[model samples]
Target: MVLVISVTVSFFWLWFIKRFETSTRLTGKPSVIFSLFLCGIGSVFAALFLAELEELLLSHVAFLSPLTYYVFYVGLCEEFGKFLVFYLAASLTDMTKEPKDGLLQAAAVALGFAILENILYSDWGLGILLLRSVMATTGHMSFAVIWGYAAGLYLYSKRAGKNKYSFGMVIGAVCTAAVFHGLYDYFLGMDLKPISFLLDAIVLSISVYILRSLKGRSPYESGDKEAVAEAIESNSNNFHLNRLAGVQALKTRDFETAAKYFKKASTVNHREISTKVCLLFTELLTGSVEEFEAYRTLDRICSSINVSNLNRLRARIAEVFAGCPDEERLLNLIDDLIDETGYRELLKERIAQFDKYANAIAGKGCADSGFLISDKNSLPMAYRHPSFYTKENNE
Candidate 1:
């Protein structure tokens, strides 16, 4: 019953912590589950690590005092152990794909470590259980937030070819967390009634501050434009496979199939522009994305490509506007929304592609959604869009 209650309380707090994080990036829940198991082992490893360090210190470093032992030894060893486990998880997989993921995964590892540590130190009293389980668990998780958020920001902000100062940003977090952990442990160890009372308010305040502060620092929020990532720093194996598949499907005029591949690719690596373009194309053709979204995505992607691809995208956008809206009004909207005058000039090229396609394929609307955009004509700018298709068209 003690163990059950401990786990139940920890679980409730874990969920409570997660409720504060508001990033929309989708990640696999299995990653968190895996971290739980990995960090449970890591807690055992931390115990052994601290034990050896203590013996080593006694033998050689008799100069070090007992008063500061909690800060230097216990805090560093435990934080280092958690860091190793979290690092392995991020490096081995795309566990830290989003900035918010750092917090989530870190919290999982902390909870796992705390739960196991509590289990080992179990006693018969409910007061002891609540103190160890609740206080210890929250402390571990709160300290973890320091490093977790930093690791995530480092991944997001570090451009391709590596940022020289990036290591400091990430490792500094661990050291910071270690110091905080030590101070927290040291304070609690004092056991004075006044100090203990003050520590509770401090812990709750710090946790709330850290969790709330993360909302403003989300990697997706720059310029009010949110994509999966800020930079395409990673080259994913699965992303490459899906990208190739999407390209092939696009060439074959299978827009629906193309979109599926691009969507999967985007999920694998948010930083990749090619995948975003492919997905954007599909959304333009099939999905009911807002007109502003359509214009915003085009403006963002247009300037980054070569003439061939730029013209391809430009011609498609012009064609879609020619078919669906007043070309003159949209031309002005394009000039207003897009930043570059030179880039806007490039989009002005007359390519009446979609109107002809719309005329050619009159009426084959899917019962569920979208029109069949498959081409029977050997058009110059042949490609597939994301959502526009039918059962017959797919066949």
Candidate 2:
């Protein structure tokens, strides 16, 4: 009954957190479920680990102060384990960009842990439930949310290529989260007399306030006209070139440049341009989650289109391109796209080429999302037209 009550309290808090963050880009169900699973597993591991430490404490190891013992045995090990769980869950999933997704996942896991811990303590009464809800449960959620939000930020901001600095930042964030978790636990464990809970409440409140303040308008604000104009021009110039150069780049396996050129071309306000280029580029360049930002930017650019059917069709195609790798998957996706876009003949021809290319690449779908990398090829200016890649290249 106590476990149930604890879970109930957690559920309400989770609901409230989700509700509050709905307007933000962080939202998803899969992430939440997976995070809870991680928490459940992590809690079991933590309990076992803590039990061993308790045994050590009872046995009396020489020169081991309570603070020193707690730091290594309780604080560091358990907190680090929880962060590890968060990272593991993220690395395995595709919804990595769903912003506050990490927070939800972490909170769920912590809540699951809290529920189990409450049950173990035999404090299933409403009073204990209420107490845990106000203090322990809230503490778990707050710490997890802090770590999760930082993970989300790191994941979102991370770019491709092996940079030591980038890798370090990710590692650093995880470690810092562990430190924060440790400090919280350590302070709670300390004999702070009557003011301990008050201190905790103040700390949690202050941390939350800081995090909320950290969120505001992005530097990549959607309303920036000058930046948008420059982006349009840059994309147009890149697009107004030959398809073979981009294709050759793919063949040579220079996916990053290929993605850049393809993206450049796709950005132009050109109706003659096939959204397929963007879709294909995204598929080839799927390694970087930053591609989602590009996709979102492209989507925003297309918001003015009268062709809702085409727009939705292309958007769905981009999504599939982001996830699937199998040639069969691409074929099925293309067929669905054609059916939706009412581009039967154009799509059929494209499909034939797509199939041939798929066969040639031998089931090598987009390298990252749909960006393919290869050696640079000299693409003639005349090849810029959408018709060029469709007709001449097939020959």
Candidate 3:
């Protein structure tokens, strides 16, 4: 009976996982295979535990009396064993990049154990097998999920240098698992007594709570890009669209247009130091070095006081352009400026420009026209408009 149940349960769990892993739309073969391998190892260890129950109980200090402690023993041993296997598996494979992947792998391990354990129980027939696959398998999957989530969180926290209290999480997971395992066993050991339903409810609630935490507490929140967009929208009242237009012009290699847009944006208003430096670059590239001196006539034109050497470097690069008409020297200076400050607006502009016109210095290698730029050409018009490009009139 146990044998038949194990075979059926394992097949179903494996099929479920195969679908779930595929549905994620992930392409790598190694992570998928490693997750399955974790499941198989978990099953074998569970079968070994069942085979040597007496020795296991002794090692666990479980005398089958005061059943709470017995459940705790089982929980501790099982949780710790699964942790060891997961750690070893992770060390051996390169598939553990994302947080959600760890939990999936843990579920595989837990399901494997449940399937094997169902097979070993002597009294279980087809009817029992069905119940075990649903109830028992689900229980094991839930338990595994708790630790799998922990593994994900720990890895994420470690990567970020934020989990100084990670050791506590292991203790917390094992103890939580023990509580749920104890409640389930206590009800089952009571042989379906009427009050057992209430205990079962409690167990379900606890399991649900752990699963919810895992779902919500994944290391990398999936919608970060959307979140950033929301923040930008929320602050739209304070954002200057004209300034952004200038940055766009510089990116498309329209230096003359960029100069006009930056001039207008700088004269009207600005705060970001990045905006000031970018405006200077535009002015320099349009062959208007003397205009840089125009800033001395006003108290200030932009909010970000230019960086100490930023203007000097721009001026030096202007001289390089003036001395030999060498675009290479000027471009090198611009690239150096981008690397030193790590400002992404410039890089993002270049990428967007390359994507659009396919003629900018940066756009040389791109092959896809549809991917390059939209037919509307909003970027070009946005930079050239007087409302966006003519700064001195606004000031």
Best by TM-score: 1
Candidate 3 clash pair list: 2-119, 264-391, 355-372
The lDDT values for all models are: 0.60, 0.50, 0.53
TM-score of each: 0.56, 0.47, 0.47
Off by over 4 Å in 1: 17-34, 63-66, 123-126, 157-165, 193-197, 200-204, 216-223, 226-395
lDDT of 3 by residue, 180-250 (tens): 65666566666763454455455546645754554453222322333223322322222244444444455
Error of 1 at 175 (Å): 2.6
* Model 1 TM-score, all chains together: 0.56
True-structure RMSD for candidate 3: 17.6
Per-residue accuracy of model 1 over 1-395 as CA lDDT, tens digit each: 77887788778866775564433222223435444545655765765677687768667665655446776677777877787787777777655544666776777787788888887777546777768776777788777777877776665445333553476887888877777777777767776535644654575577567666665554333212122223224423346545656555555566787688789888888876646755775665565566678766756765455545554555544553343324454444445434343433333321234444555564642222233434433333423332222222345
lDDT of 1 at 367: 25
